[model samples]
Target: MDIELLRDYCLAKPAVEECFPFGPDNLVFKVNGKMFLLASIDQQPLQFNVKCDPEKAIELREQYPSILPGYHMNKKLWNTVIIDGSLSTQQLKEFIDHSYELVIKGKKK
Candidate 1:
């Protein structure tokens, strides 16, 4: 999995939108106007940062070297996943779902 994979996954979701809200090289994926996924096109190893539950983020980091605190996001609430095939596609998809849900849950009320 890489930037293209991330893009495809996000775009496949209903009402999802892709943007460069952070910059040209950085891609942002949103659903219902809320961000759930973000990745840098130029970054090496094709890493992506996703909104995630703080506890889950820590667990993932402990379980896989590919998962770490997001570079530009809240360290306690997000994670950076290296797209190196370390995690199974199913697992990646699940993480994406969790990330999306977490972001949606955090929307202004």
Candidate 2:
């Protein structure tokens, strides 16, 4: 999905908000004031980092070329996903959903 679509999708979720905490080039989506996903607006092919379960994160990287260790993030808990047309739009949404849910779950603890 493109940046606009991604922004809209994230905003549609409950209690979600977008901000440029790191700078104008990086768009961060947060739930309950905690970041879940971050998109580098200045990058080509559209890449985003999302929080993921450590084990699942490694599994995804192994299963998909477009998914990799999160750029400039904690590799164990995050993943950098490249929108290189190898994955479906639904898959992208799932990644965001997983991240969002993980953050929400964290808030409960």
Candidate 3:
């Protein structure tokens, strides 16, 4: 999916909002005021970083080589998923949903 589609998908979820808290190029998607997804709007290789369980993170990276430890995030707590590769759009949506739920379940800052 492209940027707008990805943005719309996350924004459609409960209590979600979009912002550029890091800068103009970086787009952040948050739920309940906590960010769960982020990407560089100006970057290539369309992918969005998301929070993930540490064990599941390694499993995903192994299962889908396209999935990697998150860029600029704690490797143990997050992952950067390459959305346009290996996974289908449906699977990608599920991953996004999972990330949203995981963040909401995390300790609030």
TM-score of 1: 0.90
Q: Lowest-lDDT window of 10 residues in candidate 1?
A: 100-109
TM-score of 3: 0.92
TM-score of each: 0.90, 0.98, 0.92
Ranking by TM-score: 2, 3, 1
Candidate 1 has an lDDT of 0.85
Tens-place lDDT per residue, model 3, 1-109, is 8889899999999899999999999999988888999987877778889888889999998999889989999899888888656789897888898899898877454
Tens digit of per-residue lDDT, candidate 1, span 51-73 = 88788789889999989899888
- Candidate 2 matches the true fold with a TM-score of 0.98
What's the C-alpha lDDT at position 22 in model 2? 96
Off by over 4 Å in 3: 107-109
Q: Global lDDT of each model?
A: 0.85, 0.97, 0.87
Error of 3 at 68 (Å): 0.6
Model 2 lDDT, residue 65, Cα: 95
Candidate rank order under lDDT: 2, 3, 1
